[model samples]
Target: MLAPTHYPLEYHDLRLVLALVRGGSLAKAADLLGQDVSTVFRAIQRLEKALGTRLFDKPRSGYSPTPLAEALAAQAQQAEQALARARQHTLGGEQVQGCVRLTCSEAVLQALVAPALGAVLEALPGVELRLHGGPGFANLSRHEADIAVRLCQQPPQHLVGRPLATVPFVLCAHPRLLQGDGGGAPPWIALEEGPGEDPTGDWRRQHFPAARIAHSAHGLHGVAQLARAGLGRALLPRWLIEAPLQVLDEPTVACASTLWLLMRPDCRHIPAVAKVFEGLARHFTTAANH
Candidate 1:
């Protein structure tokens, strides 16, 4: 097999391939690449013609990448990372005027980061913070995100950052639902099973063996909303505690999860990334105090 570099492929072509491989669908790839689905489809067609082989198998669910496509995506990711590092080093000392992409869960964005945005912008007038909210962590090594705020027991060792807050789990529900001891297997609001391991779900199952799951949501944000609606009791981070939802002290929930602010080692020196990093760290740290 000819090496991917041996083929007549442009840098952008490789990026499209990488986006497709990561996204698993034409619409998702287009969204990541900031292109239309038709454009991505046309480009893939052209790329396949140039390479003289099929790169993906189109299935009902999503795009299944061929081995060659996977190899090309790997090379593209490495090249993107190298280019980002080179660019950061070359312009590390320049004014912090470029965009800094920050990725975190929707819950964090709504409860924490979003509230701090105006202050952050006021402090760094020249910088633009692009917020990407999702359940999955963006690949920092691939330059998918400049910074990430994650809620986990321990962040990946490769990333560089500190835990901003120790987030404990809590069982909460609408005030009306918790009129009494709130016992007897009350309805539960559960997080739907996904790609990663879920300790909270396991805790719920182990603790509440006969509990009925009345509602299911993708993440804590949705679970909280469901709890607020008096649908069921939800196990959420202590940070998410708010009005209409009161904590249930009897069935004590405990998980030593921490909120971490992380970034790539190569990004530490970039003025915009550095400034945003410091600002976010301070914001979350101060909030954690109260």
Candidate 2:
């Protein structure tokens, strides 16, 4: 058999194939994979190219796996089981001495996790941090991450953790934006949609139907930067702002996903994971109350 890397199929890619076969449709597979349809499509295409074989037979009803895919899917499930066993084995040392993989949206990492890590790194010199940030939530079940800082009303059913904070988006604008002859609502800086449609963007569109777009950005940090540069008013999460921009009096419920400090059940008891988890919990709790 080819080595794992030479095989070129990753754990997530294998799961995607299984998900597509089981879900029977692109949408359903996307849901199962915790990704958008485009992403699922792209990943499958990439996998097929890597293997130099078409794994799925396409038809109107839905995606159906071929013989090669069936065999691979079986292997994938076996790999998953092996990974679970490996999970317990890999995390045998003190969490403080080993590496911890953390996943979160860019906004959370920059505003919360990144700022707090200085203390964590200072206190535990042996601990290594591998921060993974993106638009999509990483799959804890597949060992994509050891911990996740998620912003959602309810945490996913697969993970377990505590509510770190109620992160609410508030209207904030640079002081210069409010300047000039007539005082009026500053043009809005719109946060653009990602792979999965952001519910908050729709909420903003509905609530402020007439708002003008002064700028647009794909990430919260970009939006905050634009607002700081006096582009326009921006609805930013409360924790993301430190200074220069001020929260406005305008009412907004555009987006309010709770911050959750979560870990896969299988990975949580590791001493190092536990220690870092506790520190993150304390940091967010303090940020929330303050």
- Indicate which candidate wins on TM-score: 1
Model 1 spans > 4 angstroms off: 3-8, 78-92, 96-101, 116-129, 134-147, 154-162, 180-185, 195-199, 251-253, 262-279, 282-290
How accurate locally, in lDDT, is each candidate?
A: 0.78, 0.73
Angstrom error at residue 137, model 2: 5.5
Among all windows of ten consecutive residues in candidate 1, which has the lowest summed lDDT?
194-203
How well is each residue in 1-290 modelled by candidate 2, as lDDT tens digits?
32234664567878988777656678878876779999998988988877777888889987888887777777775675566446646755433465677888787787788887786667766677777887665567645578988766676687887987766788888878767648666798887765321335766787789888878887777788898888888877876665799887877764666778888775554545666788878776776688
In candidate 2, which residue ranges exceed 4 Å CA deviation? 1-97, 118-126, 134-142, 180-185, 195-199, 242-244, 253-255, 269-271, 286-290
Model 1 quality (TM-score): 0.72
Lowest lDDT block of 10, candidate 2 = 193-202
Q: Provide the RMSD of all predictions against the true structure, rounded to 1 decimal.
A: 4.4, 8.8
Positional deviation of 44 in candidate 2, in angstroms? Answer: 18
lDDT of candidate 1 over 177-227, digit per residue (tens): 866674655698888887322458777777778889888887788888899
Candidate 1 colliding pairs: none
